[model samples]
Target: MTKGRAALLVVAAIVFLTVGFVIGQMVQAAGAIPGTAGDPLVAQSYVEKIVGETVASLQTKLDEMQAKVDDLQEEVDALSGDTGTNKGSGKTTLPQSSNPPAQGKTVVVSGDSANIRTGPGTTYAKVTTLVKGDTATMVSEENGWYKITLQDGKEGWVANWLVEVK
Candidate 1:
């Protein structure tokens, strides 16, 4: 990746971690609510709401940062005359492939119930549920999440803690 892309990725990872930390603190706070010692769902819901809001806030920031990155990429593309070189990364970008299944690697769910989500973060909507022995193809990875292709060929992302590479 280019230095610019790498920097954006670092920022994204930091956002993810910060959100996780905030949710953790919120959960701790919720657990202390009076008369709710026996019911953890309240805490769960609170954490979920916090996560959702944090994700929404970060999404806007990401969009703005992405626009900047896109502008830089466009400038680079123009100067390089649309060549395959990925400037600042010292690497050549590979041409994309048509075959989806054969393109990337695969991984299997290590946990009993793994959530496959619309995006890498837990704040993203859960699109499917995978149990132990479930498998998916690797698509992309950033932060502590894995973007995967389900066995049925649908695309989604999962938390890295839930899976092991196949």
Candidate 2:
């Protein structure tokens, strides 16, 4: 064939192949299901289902943690002599019985020096020290420890064995 005709035939053949490939791709895309090997896109329903499952799992974990916190709060209430009712105040309050000492009741340090802690235990952080003859107002007593308010209004716990209540 002549050069012109051969060139035209080659161009026509290329256009036909291109058209066929485009049509085949369109057909496959229309028939393929999302989230399948043939389709890269994921269905919205499938994504939502996975998210729902994850949320449910997280909620279960949160519920378990909340239960633990509630149990811990109950134990703290018992130890601190709280009535376990805040009257919707969301703040824990100590009962009157927890501070049975008469108002203005004081204690004198019997030892040379006594370490006053933040809590009613030696394992707690020490807040201050009281020397012999230093007196503190008694607030409460727990676990053989006396919770006292110092002259400076700071409250701390001291071993009951080291103090004489007056």
Candidate 3:
């Protein structure tokens, strides 16, 4: 054959092969083969179903958590309401004194010089001194002496004659 004709035939063959390759690629992308199960529609539906279920479950969990938070808020409100007027909790008033002397009851000093002793008697170590009108809590009273707790939480005894029950 002549050189020009042979060149033309080679060019035609190359074009045909390129066209066939392009067609093959298009067919593979279409996923039309039977039993291959790679259809775009089917894959999209599966992904959508899984995502929908996940979102629904998350919503349900959020609702349950909100319910628990609401319940806790109700309990807190109830507790706050009960604390305002409940006199039985010991936080409302001081204990009432029943006898002449009792611990934790407030009393006033009646003397100018009162010695606070370590124990409930005169022989114990003198802890401190209390001036007149110094109010203290009478812890106990024995033999005309009063065991008392000072304002600073110190425990001691004072002459009963120097303290008057208030």
Candidate 4:
């Protein structure tokens, strides 16, 4: 072959290989999956859909947490002596006559029936009656009587002779 023709053929082969390499790379890029190691490009619509779903899930969780906080606040308000009413149960809670003693002890009524009086003496008016096996928390002692708090938080006096300290 002539030197000029051989040189022309070599240049043509180099150009053809370069074009083929470029086309092969374009085809591989077109076939690659988005967001994968082969392709890092992600579509905007796909990102928006994922972000919207995550935001919705977080909003649902936040609503549930707010409801729980509201319920707990109501309970705390009721316990802190607000309105003298239990909001959850719709019941009137009586105020404690006095704070429980640091060394309060449980006592049971040993008599057939014992009077719960407003005062320690027999002259005091009867508020209620406690029968045998009825229990109360003895707050303090007064003149042969025991000042006690009932289960319902009511305070009254009972004769010590009619109760057995537990």
Candidate 5:
């Protein structure tokens, strides 16, 4: 499950467990005492102490669990390469270094209105633009983005899918 969904489930479980604890306390308080002349105050005190300790323990466990969740989220973000628009499945997938065929070549922008980003990812700002049939010199590549020099001497990166090696 996603981290968000798992976090939500943990919250829901805490709420449910809290309600159940409160209800169980109430039921226990409502019952008669074996001795002490059926004093309501004593029974209330006992139930409150038990419930308080239990809730405190539960809260501690939840805090520990939350910390674990945060650590897992960080690991996931690192594995995804932190591209906002793209996340390759990290499981059993081959790592790609660069485009073998496009490097050291002039490539034609294959897509209409391809965005030239400031960096090697679409998460970067669009420094300029390219259109279908526009030719750019491929400078380098990483993670499916190609560094290119545009016709007017502007340099930026484009999605590898947007260009064809020539």
Candidate 6:
């Protein structure tokens, strides 16, 4: 063969081999070798869907917990029996009585059924009846009784033997 033609043929072969090698390297780098094919967009979509579902589930659980907390707060308020205005030490205050007295003390019912009287003595009219564990604020002590206010804000008196100071 002529020298110029031989050199041209060699240069063409080199160019072909270089192009083939670059293509092969690109295919391998893209993970398309053998039986494998990679699609980055499809993998990214699957990961995004999983993260979205997890966030939604966490939000639902947080909402359920907040609802439970609100319910518990309502139950606590009901059990407290608070009138919302008497935040003072769980005690009731009463009007002054007609006899000699002590001031600013707490009194509790001492019997299973203690009479609440309109006045300070046995001869007074019966206003109501209080059971043991019932509490009141003593406005005064008269002759031998304690004048107190009921939970419902009514003023009444009870025999000293039927009530005690605390």
Best candidate per TM-score, number?
5
Taking the tens digit of each residue's C-alpha lDDT, what string does model 6 give over 1-166? 5999999999999999999999999987877333322444455556555655665466446546645665565566668885656332222235444554467677887655576878865445678766667898888775577889888999998877767778
lDDT of 1 at 101: 32
- Models 1 onward score TM values of 0.39, 0.39, 0.38, 0.39, 0.42, 0.38
Weakest 10 consecutive residues of candidate 3 by summed lDDT: 87-96
Can you write out model 3's per-residue Cα lDDT over 1-166, one digit (the tens) per residue? 6999999999999999999999999988776543334654456556655665665466446546655665565666577786435422321222333556656788787755566777654445668766668898878776567778899998888767667888
Cα deviation in Å at residue 70, candidate 3?
A: 72
Off by over 4 Å in 5: 1-99
Lowest-sum lDDT 10-residue window in model 4: 88-97
| Residue 23, candidate 5: alpha-carbon lDDT | 100
lDDT of 2 by residue, 101-128 (tens): 5646899988556778888654466687
The pairs that clash in candidate 6 are: none
Measured over all alpha carbons after superposition, the RMSD of each candidate to the real structure, in angstroms, is 24.1, 20.6, 29.2, 23.5, 26.3, 25.8
Model 4, 15-117: lDDT tens digits are: 9999999999999878879754455577766665566566546644654665576567677887787773544443223333354333389989885567788
lDDT (C-alpha) at residue 90 in model 6:
27
lDDT for 151 (candidate 6): 85
The total number of steric clashes, by the backbone 3 Å criterion, in model 3 comes to 1
Please say which candidate is ahead in lDDT: 1 or 6. Answer: 1
lDDT, ranked from best to worst:
4, 2, 5, 1, 6, 3
lDDT of 1 at 59: 48
lDDT of 1 by residue, 71-143 (tens): 6776888887976455434222343334333337778887555767787555466687776678888988755
State the lDDT at 81 in candidate 2.
82
The positional error of residue 24 in candidate 3, measured at the CA in angstroms, is: 99
lDDT winner, 4 or 5: 4
- Residue-level error in angstroms, candidate 4, position 97: 25
